[model samples]
Every structure is written in structure tokens, then in C-alpha cells.
Target: MSEKQEPSIWQGFKAFLMRGNVVDLAVAVVIGAAFTNIVNAVVKGIINPLVGAVGTQNLDHYSSCLSSSCEGDQGIQLMWGSVLGATLSFVITAAVVYFLMVLPMAKYLARLEARRKDQEKGTEATPEVIEVTELEVLKEIRNALVAQRGSGHDER
Candidate 1:
């Protein structure tokens, strides 16, 4: 048999776009963007200062460009302190979710499943069925014929 033809670029692109995974990813992206502002605010509000006390530095005011020309080909320099603050906030959020949501949810689901299994296991098992063999049936038929002959049942 001949190999199937490949889908065209447009067809493939459409298929990719139409898949549920892609749609879910798109929705997650939108939600993430909306949530980012709140997360950033919390970091800026609380975590940065806490870190600042330990390092004797602040995350709020962290970047300064060193290029002599203010606008030549230089992009915005990276601010490590702000990055650190963001990272710290992310860690905190991750920890909270793990402890408060994911861990507890997992444990609860596991316990529920275990309980269901236990209930099922406690019930009695079904009885085994026996299958008769052709030889056994033939033996019984022969015995019945012998007994009928002994009882004088020769109607034929």
C-alpha cells in the first residue's frame, strides 16, 4: 500500500491551532498575564523588603545603565535585585500552592480512592464455575443405560 500523503502547511497549522492543548495553553497564558500583576505587587510590597534587610540592598531600586551614550544601541540593563525579588515571590507562591492546594488535594483524593478499594475488597469473591467434559457426559450416559437394563427397561 502507498504511504498516506502529508497534510499541507495550512492544514497542519489549523490542526495545531484547533487542538484542545493549544486552546488550554492560550487560556492559561491569558490568565497568567492577569495574575502576574498581583503576584508582582505582592513581591514588591513584601518580599523585596524582607530580602533587603538580609543583603543590605533593595530590589525596588536596582538597575542603572553604564553606557556613556544614553540612547545609542544599548538595551535596558538587567536588574538582578528585581529579578531576585520576583524569584522569591515565585518560590513563596509555589510553596503555598504545594502545601495548601496540591499536597492536600492529592492526599484527600488518594484517601478517597483507598477507601473505595477497601470497601470493594471486603466483599466475598464470586464462586468458581465448573465445566463438564465430553468424557464425563458419556460415562454418565453409559451408566444410566446399564441401570435401565438391570431394571428391565427394554421397551425397544
Candidate 2:
């Protein structure tokens, strides 16, 4: 008997690399990293300036003293502006990614799924159903019994 040969490590690695999902994920990761730079620039240039209208341009500088007096490093400080800026950036990035990529892709996939379902439904054959009355059923049973007797199977 011939034995089946298992695939080598290189063959498995090649298959993994050649997969569509892996390639797509790599492209997405690269694009996402580039997009992050643009988002960071926008936050730093435009959004930070807008935030500056309320306080300092650098949000890290906008801190409040927790103690009675803010003497050197003696008092505790709450950096609310930095937190606010970070939150704004996160919201902006999420909104842009959703509107530009995720939302549209989801909508397109939904449309494709709906079309596939419609095609499947259209191609399928409807089953034929015959409604047999109780009288017909009884007649069929009688005929079957007669046929069985005609078969000449005598069990003496």
C-alpha cells in the first residue's frame, strides 16, 4: 500500500501567504497606518486650534489643581483638556473610518446577500402537492391488498 505524503512547512507557509484574506489584511493595515498620520495631522492642526478657542493650544497645559494651591509639584492636577482632545480624536477617526469604509462595505455586502437570496429563491422549483381524499386512500389500500393476493404468495 502507498502512503500519503504530508505537506511540507514551506508549502503551508506559501499557502497561508497566498490567501486572499492575508493579502487584504496587509493592505488594510498599511492603509490604516497611513490614514492615522492624516488624522493625527488634522487633530493637531485644525481640531487643536478649535479646542484652543476655549483654552490653551496645547491641551496638556490645561490642568486644574486638586489641592488648595498649585505650588510647583506639591498639588495634584487633573488634565481634563488632554483627555477631551484624545476623546475628540478617537471620535473623529471612528466616524471617518465608519463613513468612508465600514458603513459602505457593510451596506454593499447586505445588498449582495439580499440579491443572492433572491436568486436562490427564484431558481428553486416549487414542490408539487397532491391532495388525496380519505376515500381515495381506502381505495388504494384495497387495490394493494388485491394485488398482493394476486402475487400467489401462499403461506401454508
Candidate 3:
């Protein structure tokens, strides 16, 4: 018997590139990069100004000195404001992506799946039909067994 040949590296690479998920991932990456710019703009132009109403206009500048001499970067500085700003940006991005993109997509996919199942149900045999068919088959089998027993008794 002939042994099965392994796929070549080039063939495997070509298959990987041709897969639908690879294309989807590439599209997602491009869209994500574009979406990041929009989120960043919103955080800078809108959120920063709203926050600035109570504090500094820029979040990056807000920090605290941990040591006695913080002058000219001489002491340890805790840049908690930048961290807070980053957290805000992350929260905003996640909310927008979830509410606007992911939630809608999930709902649309669910509807499509439901419609597909309904269509399949219409095309395929129903459970009642299958049960009836099974009952008829069982009756035919019983009748055949009874006739066989009658013939056997006559032969004896």
C-alpha cells in the first residue's frame, strides 16, 4: 500500500492565507486601528475638556510628588492621572464597541440562525411523520413474524 504524502509548506501557507477567518482578522485589525483614532479624538476633545472644567485641561499633566523634593524630576512622581485617563479611554472604547458593534452583530446573527432553523424545519420531515413511519414499520414486522409462525406450525 502507498503511504499518504504530507502537504508541502507552501501549500499549507497558501491554505492558511485563503481561510475566511484570516481575511476577517485582517479586516478587524484595519477597522480597529481606525476606530482607535476616533476614540482617542473623543477622549481628547470632549472628555478632556469636560474633566478640565474641574481640573487641568490635560490629564497627562496631573500628577503627585511622592518625595520631599519633586522639583525638576528630583523625586518619585506618581502619574496616576495618566493612568486614570487611560482607564477612561479604555472604558469608553469597550462600551462603544460592545453597545454599538458587538451587541448589534450578535442580535443579527441570532435572527439569521433562527430563520435558517425555521427554513430547515420546513424542508425536512417532521417528528410526527417519523413516528408514524416507525409505527407502520413495527406493524409490518409483527405481521411478518405471525405469518412465519403459522407456516412453521403447518410444516410441523
Q: Which candidate is the best by lDDT?
A: 3
Q: 12-127 in candidate 2: lDDT tens per residue?
A: 99999976558557867998899888777766677667767976665567778999988787888898879976777688667766666656655554455456556888863333
Residues forming the 10-long window of minimal summed lDDT in candidate 2: 124-133
Give lDDT tens digits, candidate 3, residues 1-156.
Answer: 999999999999999998756865787799889988877776677766777798765578788998998888599999988998788767866876666665665555445545556688876322331112335444554566668767987998
Off by over 4 Å in 2: 1-28, 37-58, 71-74, 120-156
Candidate 3 overall Cα lDDT vs. reference?
Answer: 0.69
Q: After superposition, how far is residue 63 of candidate 3 from its true place, in Å?
A: 1.9
Candidate 1 has a TM-score of: 0.42
Top model by TM-score, which number?
3
Which regions of candidate 1 deviate over 4 angstroms?
Answer: 1-3, 59-156
TM-score-based ranking, best first?
A: 3, 2, 1
Q: What residue runs in model 3 are displaced by over 4 Å at the alpha carbon?
A: 1-24, 38-57, 123-156
Cα lDDT listed for each candidate: 0.63, 0.68, 0.69
Q: Which candidate model has the greater TM-score, 2 or 3?
A: 3
